[model samples]
Target: MSSTDAPRRATIADVAREAGVATSTASVVFSGKAKVAAATRDRVLSAAAELGYAGPDPRAASLRRGRSGIVAVVLEGHLRTAFLDPVTTAMMDGLTDGLADLSSGILLMRDEAGDDAAALANAPVDAVVLIGCSGRARASLEIVRARGLPVVVIEGEAGEGIPRITLDNAAASATIARHVRDLGHRDVALVTLPLDSDRERAPVTDARLAAATVDVTVERLTGTREVFPDAPAVSASGSFIDEGVRVGRLLLADPAARPTAVLAQSDLLAVGVIRAAEELGLRVPDDLSVAGFDGIAVDGISDVTLTTSVQPAVEKGRAAGEQVARMLRGERGVTQHFTCRFRAGTTTAPPANR
Candidate 1:
């Protein structure tokens, strides 16, 4: 409440008066920095509850800091759709840990906005982290740069002297593809993330391949092709289990024509392919071999350990945060590279006919 009125929201001052203590004392009770007598603490809390005073306004501290104390994380798609990916969630967790020293809050935003970089322009944040380099992400990077704020990108092009957290997507994908190839999976199919910002689900063709803007998708695909040059590729709209299931059905509908193995870009997609195989009464690694990336444990596929490449997801986020912290301190931000480790599980085997 700004002034005396008929009814007003309670403030910490009001709670202090009700508790018969000084405003600073009531504030310290909420801060929990210093210890107070049990009786005094309870009295202050009870008074706060009675007056509907939760705590001091946190914005006041940010105001004193002279910065928003917020870090904006731009995702490639809708916030709801983006959060569903465990990879993104893990990266965010790492990012939070990295920013822990700063006590900064995260501001999740969409990379693709209806207007041209309007969201990035209007975001009240001290720094920005772009997850992927869609066309929109590139634009957002420019916007943040023009505003003279620090920027860090994960798994995308952070060229032009910007710091980036990179994954060896191509090298890792090649390793996994070689694992499949060495297992005699001559006839194989590939499931990929979106080729472009449109997130269109379709059979990857020369036109789609040429128009690809997502470096991660392209890098992973490139690596696989080094092993399976003629492997048929299907691009999902996004990295999701259901999207995998959808394309899995299309790829496996004709048993006679289906590839002996499916190399999905993500574990969730691989799990979806496994589900599609089960629905068709096909035995995994017996009738159809399925492999995935990202090394995440999908709840439904616990019985079968996923054959994938485990990337350091948390470390990626933490590294990004650390770079952001460096830039915030007026220091040069360094680009960091991460690699993936291949893990073989019960999911892969030599082709049945091999």
Candidate 2:
């Protein structure tokens, strides 16, 4: 047909009429809701192909079902920064897989972006998934709840009645800490992720600990303290290598008072600590032992594998996504907990000269 004379887009009715079947039968062929005889289904599909009708409009179907078919993935920081973390990437992949059956797409947004909360409140999404939520992210809970959307939080507490996919944060950190302690590292220091919404990089004082709103950071710190009550700690602004380097320099610069070992909350921070140690002419695990969490691959950072805890990041994300799907489908969402494995890399050893 000529461009101007082209026929209108084909519809299910068109396919049904051409296939000599009812419109509902044609729809069932597409929705896979009811069983149609083999010959009828084949005829309907053939008619659809000939008419160039690729099933009903997804948007139209969603409208009919009263759903937006969009899931908002709320992160703690900017998108660029969040994607840099391997854990975030892994979890996102899993979430995508979990929502595969729904044929839904993800909308990445930050909880505390200038107007993001308001925008999210108005977005036409079926559900929201909060990744490692902090106080800043928690502040937007009211907005999401107000929209009457299903919520699934991963590694963050959103209070009762909200389904959460949690990790064994304290237990996993404790296991790693015990490994360091067993290495005869009497004098050690802790490098932590951000403790609160302020994202401060300074010594962790009791006041700051009490005010911390980041559940993951607080839980890891609790595990470390359980092993070393008197060990000094510095909270990095975020989980970036630069933040780790800055805090690492502060903790490792003073040779006289420098601890024999350092435990970082993330592999990136741990690598930064190693970089700091090397810049100060200290050999990792020889002059100053270093340990980290998140068993992410760090071949780019160093050859010395980082001793850390390997958590199922992708599974955590998938669980959250599955829960979101369930809630959206009028099913009860259940809380799930995951564990981590300890990796003994070359980075950790007995304290030098101890």
lDDT of 2 by residue, 114-182 (tens): 688778878888899988778878877778877788999999888889999998889988888899999
The model with the greatest lDDT is 1
Q: How high is the lDDT of residue 15 in model 2?
A: 98
Compared with the true structure, model 2 gives a TM-score of 0.92
| lDDT per residue as tens, model 1, 1-354 | 557656766888899999999998998999999998999999999999988888877677787877898999988878888879999999999999999888889988887756636877977899999998777788888889999889999999867888999999999999999998999889999999899888888999988899899999999999999999999999999888888889999999997799999999999999999998898998998988899999886888758888999999999999999999888888999999999999998889999999
Write down the TM-score of every candidate: 0.85, 0.92
* lDDT for 65 (candidate 2): 95
Highest TM-score: which candidate?
2
Q: What's the lDDT of the predicted structure labeled candidate 1?
A: 0.90
lDDT of 1 at 66: 72
Residue pair clashes in candidate 2? none
Q: List the residue pairs that clash in candidate 1.
A: none
Alpha carbon lDDT of each predicted model:
0.90, 0.90
Candidate 2 off by > 4 Å = 1-8, 17-22, 33-43
